[model samples]
Target: MKSSVNQFSTQFEWILNVINVGVHIVNKDGDTVFYNKMMAHIDGLDREQVLGENIFQLYPSLTDESSTLHVALEKGIETIESIQTYVNLKEKKITSINSTYPLYEDGEIIGAVEIAKDITKVMSMYDQIVDLRSQLAETHKKNKFFEGTATYHFSDLIGSSPAFQEAISLAKKAARTHSPVMIYGPTGTGKELIAQSIHNVSAQRNQPFIAQNCAAVPKELMEGLLFGTTKGAFTGAMDRLGIFEQANGGTLFLDELNSLDLGLQAKLLRVLQEGEVRRVGGSKEQKINVKIIAAMNISPDEALERGIIRSDLFFRLNVVTIQMPSLLERKMDIPEIVNHFIQKFNKSFFSDVRGISQKAMQRLLQYSWPGNIRELGHAIELAFNVMDTGEVMIEEHHLPAYLFPSGKYSVSNAQSHHPPLKDKIDLPVVLEEMEREMIINMFEKYNGNISKTAEALNIKRQGLQYKLTKYGIEKVYAAGSKEPK
Candidate 1:
């Protein structure tokens, strides 16, 4: 019986080592009892050195408070799908999603086992997809214009709200200088439109106006794209001019700048500071004069907190800053924006949809546009596609199905409980009430933790606090505070 048990244990160990997923086992004393080949590879460690070692001693960076395996072993608890980031003993930054559970023998916890899936590659792929989409959009937009002309100008910006006007004013001022400009706003808030307008009005308007979204390309591709590649750089590599060389004596608009890796960002900062770029696999550096206009869909402060943008890079790029307000903050401009889109689609689709009805407009205003102006444009386009040929006015029924999922609202039903417009219902006040209620609800849902509440609402912590103060509401807890027990 003893000989059979020993053979079974050996076979089990071998099977664990052969599995694809990383597996790590530690005894109750936190001594490594089993460390599979897969786990060793994932951790960048040798299997022989890790086996029968003290896990804490091997990984000095990990502690009882920081390690899931230690926690599970000491507490006999299970942790599922928890994301963990750490610097390995090799000093490599590693990110993985892990599941750890206590190992039990005869109703007593004897050890802990961790199953891990490294997500570094997965995250890199996701970043590439994000950058690719942005690049594709810019390419499409550029194709619509004449070879070197910018499609958007200051006059083409279609909003009358003070918030938007202020952003445009700042952009116009930024265009006059040779300094780098940083534009920050929520997604779909027309950051690209503003950037293009600045380029068209700038000193380098006649020169090449190249645009690249930092997140739109993989790191390897991005390096080559920004700084030219040499013939011997890699297999099938030909001498190529990067964006910096292409846009010399012109403007290079880098959208989603926060998506750039920190290391790449540092290189970009050096280029900006030194006014030069060196091609990959090339020895000599070439002088270039490229005006960089970087844009981000997230607030600069939030990006800083998330480590998406390097502090030194941001300071260098933020010589001029433009903050575009979201559609919600500038709701008064929706009517004009909608009208503009209607005319645009009419010309594009050959449909003469005159305008949107007041009822439909009201429904649009009521919606919290998570996608901002872009979503509004899409909704209008969708309505036009489904409208009848002779339909002169867009009504509630013409709107997208998702906008009114419950059912279409009749004009009478919409106005049933509302006072007559002759009484002059304050539109701003009503909107403010709705906004305040949303903030309060999210605040409570997050247990008054300002950071979590702000994240849930997709706004900056400063913005949330401003709203809270505007509404005369007090937070139950401070930012980053834990929930009440």
Candidate 2:
């Protein structure tokens, strides 16, 4: 039995030294019996220097009334998660949250052990953020030209379909009032874009406008970030305004609103109903004049059915709800969207790629586009990367290989490669572009080996040679060059 106790004690000591938490133990006589390395560093003293020193000698500021360890020792009272601030032996100010307990041996008091987490640096960082937020808030109040952060306006929403237009009309009406607006749609359908557009067009456009993606932020930190924090709210928290206060008199856009837990949703509902907010761990409620715009990736009914969104909160935010159209539902607008992206990338890439070929454009129209508008933008951007310099059009092969699921419908499968064309799409030009990019990609793949490139194209060597020569691709990118002739 004694051997087992000795073994456990040895393991405990090893663990005390291994962990970052400060550990200090003293005998009943008030002499330091064990002081681990972490405790030494935290107290700014060497282990050799504090090993046998009396507790009072090491921390002269500590007393029977003030020190948690002293209370645990003399009074047999354990203190858990108590905040302690004191100067160390080096005269450096330290802040810690400690749990101190009295040690017992056979129902008799033997000693005291204290575990402390150093929070000095954390407190310092929190104070810095609080100061910065205070400055930002003051700036917003004094500066009229400081328009909020929303960059997209109503003009930026680019789609001509009726479903898209209906969503836009509802969103424009939301901007006229400060009522809470909720926008729901499938993922990447531009709920955030609509939210930003509303803020940009509203009366409070000159005030602060900020967004918080509930899905991106961790659940534990969301409350403090949304509702603000009071000093000493937790071990290291400092008084700071949250997203609600930061965007006072402007807009607070909460994207993926369903990602917040039910408890947070209830708190959000109260703020919407009352026009007031209370900081975390704070007793006082302050009035804030801010517009709230909430976005959800899924439908409100679906979110409510899954218990992901509270019914009361949904009712409050539903005062002006807008449902954005999925790209598939507005597929007729693909040409305009594609052309807009083409013009956008032309300026950004500093390239003059004229437009997408008919066959490639048709393929895009046929795609299901699970990612919606975001996916469409990404597809165009990808085509730009592979499109040959000086080429006037984005060809079918230049689009991402992922777009053609399992590569089954790629240019190599030429018999089934062509998208069914409308009246205006010139079949000869579309076929020529597709054939050229296919041979070019194959040449790059096989390092311009005639036999392999022809075999991969499922054609005879002579035929492949004639086609490459016919298209003038035989010399320009024969080996590894991606440059167009």
Candidate 3:
């Protein structure tokens, strides 16, 4: 029986260690008895340093009142997804969503076990996004000239295509009134720009123009962000005005509305119908006067068919619907848009690249732009990065290889660059290969500096680290190893 118990213990330890989540087990006295590899990695502590150490001694930032493990063990209470920010043994601040439960022995709690998922990067991004709304609210009070600065206007948009103009015209008319407006289009078709342009010329021109992407924000945070959180709402929540209240008398643009949870969509519909917003945990509803601008990549009908969006809410937002045409639908406007991007980048990169060559323009025109205008802009920026400092024109070679016939994601294209992938036929696999190759090339360009490469790629260093791990590129590229982790 003793041997069987020991074998069970071994299997349990192995299973716990292999899982991705951090696991920390502590006794009633708050002394850590078990610390997994992932937990050590998360806390930046060695097992030898953490094991047998009291929770208070290990984490200076956590008090008995604040520590989930302590409360769970002492009070026999379970804490579910309680976000905690504490200083680890290494003195690095870490934020995690922790679920802690008291371990029971014959109905008496003897210890606590915590399962933690690191969300430091996610919290940082959430804070940045949420703080922007707070700052915008504060700025609205200070700056009487206008609300948060939204630069795009009807005239600034680069498109002469009839389909594009029709969308813009509808947006301009929407701006003239206070009715809710919805813009539907494919990704990278400048839906946000259109929303901003409408807000720029609207009655709420000087009011708050807050745009939140439904897909970008985490679901756990969506409710509190959209509807302000009261002080006692959650563990660390504070009294704050939601984006709706912040954009009072102005416009609040919710992009990718289909990505919003249906339940939240119902709440938003209530806000629109009642002309007020209720804080997530508050009792009173605060009256607000704000115009709503919503956008989605898919058509509303499709969203309804999929039940991703509430039908009642759609009617409230459908008063002014503008269908933004894809860039492919407006091929006649590509040359002008390409030139605009070239000029924009010349100033941004401080390079004197004059314009796109005829062959280069033809290369861009040849490919069906699956990613649309944003892809074109990215291609131009990449060209600026790859070209020499004094190069004058964006030549054919300066454009992305994917735009060329030889580098297309077809079987031939895959075989040319990746011989082993000659037999692979998956489009996603080919695209991933292209993405990895781009990262590798960017790393080479920047001498494997994580920061430089990530900056050039317009991604966070953590995101770059994730990609590196995904591709096992860091094993091959050692220069990035010297970077501060």
- The best candidate by TM-score is 3
Tens-place lDDT digits, model 2, residues 166-253: 9999999989998889999877788888988999889988887778888654454578778988876754456889888888888989
lDDT digits (tens) for residues 269-352 of candidate 1:
899999989997789899999889999977899899989899999999999999999888999999999999999988986777
The numbered model that scores best in lDDT is 3
The ten-residue window of minimal lDDT in model 3 covers: 415-424
TM-score of each: 0.58, 0.64, 0.76
Residue-level lDDT for 410 in candidate 3: 46
lDDT of 1 at 160: 84
Colliding residue pairs in candidate 2: none
Please identify model 3 stretches exceeding 4 Å from their true place. 1-11, 27-31, 53-67, 70-78, 86-93, 102-111, 128-132, 349-354, 387-391, 408-485
Residue pairs in collision within model 1: 131-215, 131-216, 132-216
Cα-based lDDT for every prediction: 0.76, 0.79, 0.81
Overall local distance difference test of candidate 2: 0.79
Identify the superior model by TM-score, candidate 1 or candidate 3.
3
